[model samples]
Target: MAQQALPVRTARLGRALGPEPTSVSGVVLLLPGGEESSVRRPSPMMATASVRALGRRLARTGRADGLVAHVVHYRYRGWNGGEAHLAQDASWAADEAVRRYGDVTVCLLGYDMGARAALRSAGHEAVNSVVALAPWLPEQDVATPAEPVRQLAGRRVLIVHGTNDERNDPELSFRLAARAKKANRDVCRFEVHSDGHALYQHRHEVHALTEDFVLGALCGRGFSRPVEDALQAPPPLGLRMPLATGFGRSLRR
Candidate 1:
């Protein structure tokens, strides 16, 4: 069946909106990557094909009816290492979302460096879940003042990475997820085989996976059987360690 088109418009304070703001089932904040053009305009990373598709799908699909979606535009183009200025921007956007939605559920969706911002700011009380695509976690990086992974102790987090990524090491994302899981946070890590950091080869698949999580988290509508199977499938390569554990062996009776 064909889906109806959702209204879209630019809002004040660097936000893009979909659907009417009077009432909404949930609010989704989309954070774009740090890669910017010479003029600091909204780069392709800001509106990745997958991210844009997910926003439109949520707006039109029955599972996410009345969802309010926003893609944030950052003030600058380059990533400010350890400063987390983008995290501050995202946190402020979250506050504005809450003010507009009035006690509604909220989800943070991000790609690349934007994923870092979302992960760092998940400590906000209103965020119900976070979806990060191709997150760039540099090696040997001490946690910034933002303390990104440490903040997801009680939030739902989904990190999806591609095995063929050349720009960012997929292992870094796995390590981040492991840390989050060890903290007893609800977390899931999925690896897409034969794809790069941008995931251009399988764009639709990327969008579909993200859409399933966002809808489920916000509306309690679980993913279809096919999607569920894909998510549960074993990794294409590398070790798949358990994200949870029983009591320490020494403490066993």
Candidate 2:
């Protein structure tokens, strides 16, 4: 059955919902990046082609049952790293999703600042996993009451950053993964070589990894065998990058 985009509402929050099915397998809260000035003029989440594409993919290829997806539009457009304005919006959306869907497992997918918000908010009760794509991490020290890399201790987390990205250094994402690992948190890092922040060069790979994680979390199967094996084998546990380039570039400039 072809899934259709439908409207899912919350009393006073922003709009949410993507291709939904009759029986929802799980819920994903999708967020996009924005500037502080956007607080007065937030962008519509559903309008983002990349975000909708991911939602559609989940709706189509997820297990036997489809997934419920929500793209969040922040009440405030900016990240407000010190205050976590965006994470609060995500929390509201997650709460509404839980209220409407009942105790289902929830996954979060976000990009740039949105990724920061998702990671900050992953400690919530309903979230089981998080996928942060090209997340913007400057100096890697931004933490609000809503976040700390340690907050995600028991949840599955994936951080995919492009090595060539000039906007946000991939090293920040790596540092985040390292911090989580040091604390014994479940975390995976995929450093995409030759790609930029948008991950345009490896969008398909990003989608596959995200889909696998979401499906695994929802079905109670955990990560796939290849991922499991990789995670258990070495230093960069579950790190996915092109096999051709050996570690891509030096960790330093």
Candidate 3:
């Protein structure tokens, strides 16, 4: 039988994450990479694609007892505001996720510009974990996030970036992850030998990893799979990575 194309439901994104927690106890918010021109609009197709693949890979985690997995479409950050725009969007998404989902945990999944946006959203209270795919962080390049996220000290962040990212050096992802770790002990980075700036080359591997990690979070260490295996990255340097305090040290904001 032919598989049905996942339906694209246009749902409002602001306020109330809605009420009701699925068995998995979480949801994924897909944000757009920043807008540089008319070209920077949110890619519903790509967002949907990520959600489709991730939602399936995440199936065993939430669906064990028929839990519903919602793939959210975050508000678009139309030109201007740079990192600050991303930072604010992230917070709004978190607030909305909690309101709608109530007590369920929230895991943010963002790529490219969206990835940076997801990272900014990390400091919010309800976000249990963040899946930052090729994210940019707050630093000289971008301003420190709004007061709230800047204060997040214990949130969990996961970063995945390809060795061949076109827009920026892939090393940027590691740097951001390192900054996040320095910011909070729970951050980790996974480097994938993916192609281009897209998620085309390593679908199955990525999907498997997402399934394991997200499940591991909600199940609270009871996942059949070991968390060590899920990371699939270099050994975490334990929590003392030097913060990026130089190179572009700004005098004032």
Say which candidate scores most in TM-score: 2
Write down the lDDT of every candidate, Cα atoms only.
0.67, 0.69, 0.53
- Candidate 2 lDDT, tens digit per residue, 16-63? 344457776588888777664343546464335557778667756563
On residues 1-253, what C-alpha lDDT tens digit does candidate 3 reach at each position?
9986533433345222223333435666655565532224356666455455565445444565333445555444342454355556667766766786577677767766667667666767777777766554333435444323344356666666666777656665665555555556656655556445665576555555555556556545432222343233343542212212121123121
Ordered list by TM-score, greatest first: 2, 1, 3
Clash pairs (backbone) in predicted model 3: 16-99, 16-100, 17-99, 17-100, 17-101, 18-99, 18-100
Q: Each model's number of backbone clashes?
A: 0, 1, 7
lDDT of 1 by residue, 1-253 (tens): 8986423422223344445544686888888777522224345453444466667666665333657787776655545664466677788788888887788788888888878778988988889899988887667635533235777877767787888989888888887776676664457776778879887776666666677677777877775443344344444222232211111212211
Q: Where in model 1 is the C-alpha error above 4 Å?
A: 1-17, 36-50, 62-64, 141-147, 224-253
As a TM-score, model 2 comes out at 0.80
